[model samples]
Target: MIKKLSKKLSVSLSKSLDGNNEDVEIWTYGLELLLNGTIKFGLIAGLSAILGTFKPTFLILITFAAFRCFGGGVHFSTYPRCLTFGVIKFLILGSISNVKGNMFNYNLLFYVTLFLGILTIIKWVPGDTEIKPIKNKEDRKKQKVKTTIVLILWIIIVQILIRLNSFKYILPITLGALTSFIFITPLGYWFITSIDNILDKTKVKYGEVK
Candidate 1:
């Protein structure tokens, strides 16, 4: 539905503006990405609010953006699957963080997460896909540096929060950071690709049945 809508809108706009086939294609792709992101984020926010986990969910998303902005990650084959998977993943993070408060050592978790995150960024920061490869060596270097800086800043901020007795925020922030860094690791790539393949096979089987 989103793909069809994007194509229709792009074609209509192209017709109105005398755009060529190439322009329409470009517009369609861009619009599809924009629409998918907007809808996915909206659904996540709405569901989090309804589930009474909005604060933790919002923090997780914010932390995700902070790290992911500098560290590129894997992409799914389809918009619907991406949206579905992301919504469920973040919701789980939020719910777990909310319910697991003070049950374990948050300080230990924070240190472990920070350590793993730094090592992952050092090894695979600016991870790229076939569709968006970072071929430039300088660009890759810059991304790694920026990601490291962000991780450092996160460490400082989390420490401050801890000193202030804001323990409730610790787990969500750590989870978010951990999730973002995972996307750049070998295991992360394999995991996401396996999911995409499974979903694709399922769709094919359903179509055959129909």
Candidate 2:
């Protein structure tokens, strides 16, 4: 449904703007992202309201998305699978923040996440796609620098939150950063590919991947 809508909108807009085939493709991709983001985050916000995890969910979403923008991550083949699984994953992380108590040194966990995040950014950032590969070395370096800046800002934010006696906020940021970092790693690609294959089989069996 979203795919069709995006195509229709893209076609209409392209015609209105006297755009060619390339414009249509670009518009389609952009519209799909906008529509998918709206629907996915709308569902997440609604669920968070019911579960009383709005802040945590919002934090996780923001941090994950920031990292994802600069550090390209693996995407599911279909939007439906991405939306479904993405919501579940974020909701679970947000809900986990609700459980009170220190679980084995959050400071240690934060530093460890920071260390791994920096390493991942240096090694495999701009983990580009076939559609939008970062072919230029300069572009790849810029993306890595941007990702490192975001990681640093996230670390500072989490640390400040801790100092302000707002401990609950730390978990979601850490989880979000860690999860996004995984997507840039070889292991993360393997993990996502495995999940994608599983979902593909399931969709074939169920006839749901339109």
- Model 2 scores worst on lDDT over the 10 consecutive residues at 97-106
What lDDT tens digits, residue by residue, belong to model 1 across residues 66-154?
Answer: 98888988878766677788999999999998865563588778878888888888788898998889989999999999999989999
Task: Return the TM-score for candidate 1, rounded to 2 decimals.
Answer: 0.87
Residue lDDT tens for model 2, 106-167? 87778788888988988889887766788899999999999989988997898799889788
Clashes of 2: 0
Instruction: Give the alpha-carbon lDDT of every model.
Output: 0.87, 0.87
Each prediction's TM-score against the native? 0.87, 0.91
Error of 2 at 148 (Å): 0.9
Model 2, C-alpha of 162: deviation from truth (Å) = 2.2
